[model samples]
Target: MNALRCLGLGLLALALPVHAEQLPRWEVGMGVGGVSMPDYRGSDETRNYLLPFPYVAYRLEWLKADRNGVRATLFDSDKAELNLSLGATPPVRSKNNVAREGMPDIKPMIEFGPSLDFNLWRNEADNTRLDLRLPLRAAIEARSNPRSAGWVFSPKLNIDFVGLGMPAGSKEGWNLGLVAGPMFADRRQNAYFYTVDEEYARADRPAYQARSGYAGMQFLTSLSRKFGKTWVGAYARYDNLHGAVFENSPLVKRSSYITYGFGVTWSFLQSSELVDVGDN
Candidate 1:
């Protein structure tokens, strides 16, 4: 649910990204788009959701907000930096998914914490770089109010190539990014997605307790380019749950799944001067 719900925005943010050449101090706008994605993490079902995307990202002296997630760069150097990671997940309704039929609906989950990033490799003249990122976030859910769920630690290796040559062998306009990593969650987070209680359990699904363990692995790639007032971004993601600790859960439907999306952002308003980076 967390991965699928945010995939759209994540992709769009890439599409509407701010490039180095057009480093506008700030940007503000909105757009309407759509994304087709699976119902949840382990479900085989699919649904299309229309998205009302709000555009907001501030590049400032101390903070930077973009598709990469909001952060206050407390420490920044050529190689390593530390900041906060803000992320969230959408809820899954039991009635909407077959495998979760009789179970209670899930509440929205939010994560916030810190991250340490290191520049594993950088070739600025070639416009390429590799980064290793480690982020630890506390998970929470808001049903009646915010309640702690558990925690997640995701470490990823990210590679980027900007304004570089493409498959056609031209460097006119293209930006590419690739990232992969494993996700780990505590027992509470696992229970939130895999546990089954006696009251709502069906004949096929018995009451069971879940334990803390590995969640899954994810790989994502994105490609983008800008054309005048419009920008296009395309992305694909894969999640492997075959080796996941909760694979035995009755509510778990598929062992693997793919989520992809395409989006476009139009820029009608922009600034050239160094404007104050507003709150995003």
Candidate 2:
């Protein structure tokens, strides 16, 4: 079922073009920078490294109009947007290898998968408005030296309140946004690190499995701005997990982490011609 869903999403993204000049729209960008998370494992600092992420979006404008002096447009019926992204973060090695018991001796890392975005609102006046975006992300994660692999299906929501009304002279280009969501992982993925089976489980740790229930919740706030044709943003995120799913995991154990980072985006293409809408 999961593989089928991923294939379906991949097809959808492939069927849609990255750009539509008419009522529809599309955008693609790439970014690279450093990111860090503190507060994991009762420590002041832990995971920190450079990462690169790139994404593309395809929006089909089904409705366009002006109401109450605000212009509105709906893509995928105001419920969703076609989004695809790929990212990789360099592995983090422990400083005090001996002190890190139960911790994977290998590097800690993350990988991204297919995702979808649902937009709630957009302000036409300044092309900025409140938006609720959700991402259905699949993950391939690894921790410790043994190099165990885990798969996670994480769905996250981001609420964006763009400050379009700010004074032009001030930091008017800045937009503030927040993100919150939960993640679910399959038992196999969870068991890779959390569970202690006779063969797979660690020697000192008791038997455990990453459960299918609500694994964790995350909160993030971000500020974004545009400079000429380039876009720049910075964000801070807090992660908290319940029970042993996260607390017992070798990679992300400790239950909580704070991630802060900045990134720059560059557009590769732009078109003026609109998509030809056929008569139905």
Question: Each candidate's lDDT (Cα)?
Answer: 0.71, 0.44
Candidate 2 lDDT score at position 174: 58
Give per-residue CA lDDT, model 2, range 105-202, as digits (tens). 33334444544555555444333333343433444544344443455556665544443466532333456666577766676555443444444345
Measured by TM-score, the strongest candidate is 1
| Model 2 root mean square deviation, Cα atoms | 9.4
Best by lDDT: 1
Clashing pairs in 1: none
lDDT of 2 at 32: 57
lDDT of 2: 0.44
Residues 37-131 of candidate 1: C-alpha lDDT, one tens digit per residue: 66667777777766767666567777777544565767647567786766667677879888788777878777778988777876535456787
TM-score of each: 0.87, 0.58
Q: Which pairs clash inside model 2?
A: 21-274, 22-274, 22-275, 104-144, 105-145, 106-144, 106-145, 195-208, 196-201, 197-201
